[model samples]
Target: MFEYQLGIDFAKTLDKNDPLALYRNQFHIPKDDTGNDLIYLCGNSLGLQPKTTKQYVNQELEDWATLGVEGHTEARHPWLPYHEFLTESMAKVVGAKPIEVVVMNTLTANLHFMMVSFYQPTPQRYKILIEADAFPSDKYAVESQLRHHGYDDKEAVILWKARKGEELLRYEDLEQILENHGHEIALIMIGGVNYYTGQYFNLKQITNLGHKYGCKVGFDCAHGAGNVALNLHDSGADFAVWCTYKYLNSGPGSLAGAFVHERHAHSKTLNRFTGWWSHNKQTRFKMRDAFDQLPGAEGWQLSNPPILSMAAIRASLDMFNQVGIEKLIEKSKMLTGYFEFLINALKNEHIKIITPKNQEERGCQLSIQVKTADRSLHEKLTNAGIICDWREPDVIRCAPAPLYNTYQDVYNMVEKLKNILNE
Candidate 1:
């Protein structure tokens, strides 16, 4: 466990000793009107751009301008198999095999596509299970799927909710829900990391329980991808999906990733929505050839991906490859632990941390529930040049990203919070 200390000097000392400290310079930190750096603690929402992202994107633009249609096969990186460049690195980030991982459609789109194959509902087992506070897009997609299948959304959606007075979800509660209604559930879809509370659920445990009940299980890993070691393959999940714009540091609305367990990689019989890109590459160019599905996760592709957005993803993944997820997570635990310690030091009655205190149970995000606090407080923080995420009602989510955020940044942010609370 990390032993954290108070005072600005301690924060600076930690930053000096941090092996990943130099990485902060690799990102383009946001600046104020006077050009001073803002204390950015919003990686859970959107990660900052890497300095090299521009160069990476420009290369694609240059190739497109020069090669025209020939860029598909003859450009520097070769656009025809562009997504292949990201497979190995992305697989490493999400802890899956190359055959099991693919970078493709947006987060919700991929979720729907995976559902096409995995959420095969029967009259006897037609329910879909998800956390009560699953991300809105996931909830919407699943609800739409149920409606399309002729099931009432309200009747078919099962919520695994937190207790009346508690904020964090318990595994026992999930077990109880499954015990009673597992037979009726055709699919158990959950967030690998709860977006609101930063709770990192045990994916393997959830998958095991769902499979035991004869249900297909998958995860929406939007908040967990680069922030945690997901190990999607080892979890034995049927599938998983995540966006690149968040912790992955890709540009806004960038392409997303999907994972299918290798066991299902070659299942040509699995029902799915396919297009020309999903066909065998060799026969894909043969316009008159019959549809021969490409094996593995690549079979999910609908159309050729945008190479510029992919360039941004490549820039971020290259950094992840150099640093390694293990090292980043090690620093994450320490940085987040230190942030927690400093916040608790305030000893204020109104402030309570809703996110789990256990390093193993949560990521870098700490959801601070300030009693009676309102949007005015959020406005104050913004005016003070602190960029944090303000969820509706009363939560301030701050994530000190391990790649670029420093210990001093955490200290400064807490100091600003303390001053605001004092007022």
Candidate 2:
């Protein structure tokens, strides 16, 4: 329904008609040394800081300074239930029920925690399946899980990889793997969105395939949580984990999110590591009581959270609540589609768009493979005031975040890329 043209005026026209266009101004766009706004297209790596983030975090700091010990209950947000404030909005972001979702530790840490309860392995079925290109942290976590359970890491871990000449994975291959190794596999944990190729997997499909094989299913949605409609509950995955620092726009090292399907909310038989925070809130302060596991995902908490970090997440989630993820995703498709249009229009054989072309199978990120080019191309782009990131070998990941990016930004980035490539 959209005809993409090549010009700044067309991009400006599109921006003028965009309902979320004004949201761009709500962020602090990094400026070049010359005081011009840098073309930031790295939301997949680190999102631009929301202008209100400071206010949200400072509110807590002021409460601590003024109330001291009383801040736990006397503060406006009530530190006693600080994480609860984030539950509804975060659940909305990932399309989950509040009881199924919780804001907890960092991403990899949360991944390991979820594995403890979900990755139950036995001698007959003890292998774990993951994407061949999973983020290094996930790979390490899963491998360690296998070794921790007295299995050889290399022998117990299975990689669902792309075909010999392909970069994207196919479900047929996964089905084949399960058909053969189904009995031997204990868990299937893959990135909901592939970090390097920007491919969005079908979570429900993966979960179904794993369940059919009698293996537990999980996803690391660090890239998909805020960027797509995850529908974690409907997907019926056993659990999922993701961080807030990316599209969620929380600060660096901010608290991550976790999801446990409602079916497992009160599964007392499931093994889990817990702390006082996971105890029943009503009697938590009693000090000398037996452990009463709080039902749902909240029971996974190991400690009282970092309020300052959680405050930043609260700020970002509030914006997400106002705009809604579905609306943001609609804009994301248009923004990233426009980005793809311009890249293809270049027709430069030296550059290839490695990410999937189908909007339904990808997020805002476009992983561009600069054929035969090295890090020098990335350096030149950085010098030209573009804030995209360079992955090792030959890919540059650029994401036009719907919350704070414009059509004009996409147009300008492509124009700059064209000029650089022509030179």
Candidate 3:
């Protein structure tokens, strides 16, 4: 019935021809009870750890064990300036310059830190604008930021909601919100991509609109960092932050990244909560009485970071660098497109995709709105060893990570899903 839809064997042929197929060997794919590979489709949540993560983290562990306090100066990866080792490669991943980016803290902490400098809510412009369906952590962060500035979140925060009966956000509605509240909105902090709908927002368009309205702009890129080309440097956002544990494949609950536009890098007077790492590296160990800050995003650092986490990042960044973001994205487009094709071929009318249909509007993830099916259907998929996630109210997000997922995996997933739905 799907002569053009291609079979599981055809997907295998494509995988054989894939230039990035070799990357699958670099990661440790999860296996099921019988020792079969569990088709992992949750890279949107936590990525598979790179095999080199152990080697990189071991370097730090050995240093801490042997050099102790001296590890800062004597270790293979010096603890004092350890984060510096990752600057170039990490910057490339998000299309940033070395000075524009820094890896530190967790996702929420970095958001709080970025807000300290960028959110600048004033008397006339005290409101914060965010997506109505933002991640719970982000909602809390913005709400608390409003409260911290002596404003009620109920009154001071504006939500850009998805249209009624629609799961996706529209750019036109965003334009309308900006036209209405642009003057009072202090900052436009949005997720570069919506997690639930798998929609990648138009960053440049949003940035332009917010800028035209005299509002500072920022993005929470947790879902966009590795899944899509955030083009953060070119997007003209005032600042952006993301966690590495997601599609970046760093590790679970890993260190996060923060970006500051170059224009604000040297703004020493920009308000921030600082610590020793944020201090000038030259003057940091001087035992000075004054609190001197560093330049660029490094100025946001609060404490000496966990080096082991940095090592895990370095390991993953190396993989990203070797594979190149552009190539990975290219493969992701094809691989995900193939998955979409196969699913659309399903004779069952019960499954519908909630993610945007256009390639430009999404990444690898597809939020399947299982028509008339309950959570038990997802339980069956899980039992069948399809490692996908089911969110509340009936949405299952499946991401075929370019770094490891193959076309055959997509074909197999759809075949099983078809069979189960039929039963």
Evaluate all candidate structures by whole-model CA lDDT and list the values in order: 0.95, 0.94, 0.91
- Give the Å error, residue 179, model 3: 1.0
Error of 2 at 299 (Å): 0.6
Model 2 RMSD, rounded to 1 decimal: 0.7
- Cα lDDT tens digits for candidate 1, 1-423: 558888999999999999999999999999999999999999998999999999999999999999899999998899999999999999999999999999998999999999999999998999999999999999999999999999999999999999998989999999999999999999999999999999999999999999999999999999999999899999999999999999999988899999999999999889999999999998898889999998999999989999999999999999999999999999999999999999999999999999998888888889999989999999999999899989888999999999999999999999999999998
Off by over 4 Å in 3: 1-4
Supply the TM-score for candidate 1. Answer: 0.99
lDDT of 2 by residue, 1-423 (tens): 788888888899999999998898889999999899999999998988999999999999999999997999999999989999999999999999999999999999999999999999987999999999999999999999998999999999999999998899999999999999999999999999999999999999999989998999999999998999999999999999999999999988888999999999989999998899999999999999999999999999989899999999998999999999999999999999999999999999988998999999999999999888889999999999899999988999999999999998989998888899889
Ten consecutive residues with minimal summed lDDT in candidate 2?
1-10
Task: Give residue 104's error in model 2 in angstroms.
Answer: 0.6
Clashing pairs in 1: none
**lDDT by residue for model 3 (1-423), tens:** 123356667888889999999989999999988898999999999999899999999988998899899999999878899999888888998888899999999999999998998888778998999999999999999999989889998999899998888999988999999999899999999998898999999998999999999999999999998888888889999999999999998998999999998888889788899999998888888876598778898989999999999999999999999889999899898888888888888755777899998888999999999877778989999998899999877888999999999998888898889888878
